[model samples]
Target chain A: MREDHHDQPHAPDHPMTEFEWRVDAVQALLIEKGVITADEVRRAVEEMDARTPAQGARVVARAWVDPAFKARLLADAKATIAEIGITVGFDATIVAVENTEKVHHAVVCTLCSCYPRGLLGYPPDWYKSLNYRSRAVVEPRSVLSEFGLELRSDVEVRVLDSTADMRYLVIPVRPAGTEGMSEEELADLVTRDSMIGVAQARTPALR
Target chain B: MTRVHDRGGWPGSGPIDKSEHDLSWWEKRTDAIASLLMSPEKRVMRVDELRRAIEDMEPARYEQSRYYAKWLHAIETIMAEKGVLTREEIDRKVRELSARR
Candidate 1:
């Protein structure tokens, strides 16, 4: 569980801020009023913490190895993922964008940190930064460059802006020279940044 | 006018900070509470309402606030708005908790 960027200033040993105190008070009052129980909150925390990019990596690896599953995923991401036992608890529609030989796709929620949290877990701090929110849509190539991803001139870059009701998952093109690798091995190459389209999947030689 | 929270395509923003830190206990607790409040079974508040509250914030405050802090602020605002909790009660509880520390 990575700490959010703002909470960095006040470590656990440090005194709680007014806002942190308010968070505690809010939970206490909610429980007292029967609005929510302590148990429910604990369970919710565990559920959220359990989700990580590993889930998305598995999905990517499955898509890489299984053509039929890839077709199903690209056609309908939410239902397809649910078929593999990944529950999308939220109501938002997830669209899986594939990176082909001619096109690349990236995702950003310019309005807020709206992401495919149900699939990829909590977004990283940089994804929520104002810089990413502002620039990802306008200058995706340069942003990708900052992440050390240089795409060929022939491959077009399309930045998908996620709204509250819609999200995107980028399925990076499979890396070269792993023709005989199993799904589990391929999953290891699917970095979180690759799924976000800032970088490509790791090549077998690099690994 | 483009709102602060709606920051797409606005120019001159600096480099992104890619560093990550471990979530503090309270931070995780805050996330849990917020998530439960918005869950289907609870329906205490919707995510859209939370986003609206955060967007309605003053620009300077919105820019300065942290990710989960923004979430906390929105949760506080919505809880108060829906009469699920009152601002006075929350403030009083905060004061009481502060004194105990």
Candidate 2:
């Protein structure tokens, strides 16, 4: 007999996958190429999730402290956001709706999820749901009611529709008694719903 | 090691095991380009149009493949490279690409 193992077959080493193997491979290659470190990639993803500017908290905080800036934001959301170095006009048309105690504003992308992520970071879970889409336009009051926000009947509900081009974000009026509060403290009170015009911004109770 | 005699069974007579096809660099690049098409604001292409565009861009090897299958793969590949596309830049790029010959 020939002293060879050529007649034997070996199992294949790799199995083909139908998933996004290429993306993972590219990230690995980027790490290897030193273009971006593994830590950098992780941090970037975390930053994206942690505080997307779409909330417009920065704008709200500035508005709380500066009346002139607040006037600018109310006049033009796109220009105001740009002033803060957050690009807002390229993708979705951002409109700034002011919410006061007497009259509240609520925004909805009836056609799609047109949100200002550049200012707010990320859209909340409910913003992307069908209930929000269907109810926001037809019954804004009912939807807001569910979120524990009941508007007085006298208050006009100005619901802004965000289509492909015109995206809107609500600029909530600064809560009372929050005077002398730091920008960070004001930002903390600016919830995602407050920016969407669904609910009023809440402040800490006095001790 | 012990030597063995031929048993009637032949070696390598079974079907050739298919090689795992890793996406090439060009394929990945094409995917990155395609990701620009998906944005929240842009008027997205219809299924047929998307299929046509992908087919036109694909290499000659994949030309005869099923249109829907390949296009689905392209979209899936795009979603994987999530950071590759932004709503604004992609919309502009898509418009520019669409205007091209």
Best by TM-score: 1
Candidate 1 chain B has its poorest 10 consecutive residues by lDDT at B20-29
Sliding window of 10 residues with minimal summed lDDT for model 1 chain A: A1-10
Instruction: Tell how far residue A71 is off in model 2, in angstroms.
Output: 1.6
**C-alpha DockQ of every model:** 0.69, 0.03
Docking class of 2: incorrect
Off by over 4 Å in 2: A1-47, A50-55, B1-101
Clashes of each: 3, 16
Model 1 agreement with the true structure over B1-101: per-residue lDDT tens digits: 77788788887887777787767667788888888888888888888888999999889999998888888888889998888888889999889877866
Candidate 2 chain B: minimum summed lDDT over ten consecutive residues — where?
B1-10
Where is model 1 more than 4 Å wrong at Cα?
A1-12
Q: Candidate 2, residues A1-207: lDDT per residue as tens digits?
A: 122111122224643233223333443333344444444444434444444643478778888888888888878778886787766423455667777767788887654355776456556646644456556776778778877788889888988766546567777878789878998788888877788887888866722
Residue A26's lDDT in candidate 2: 40
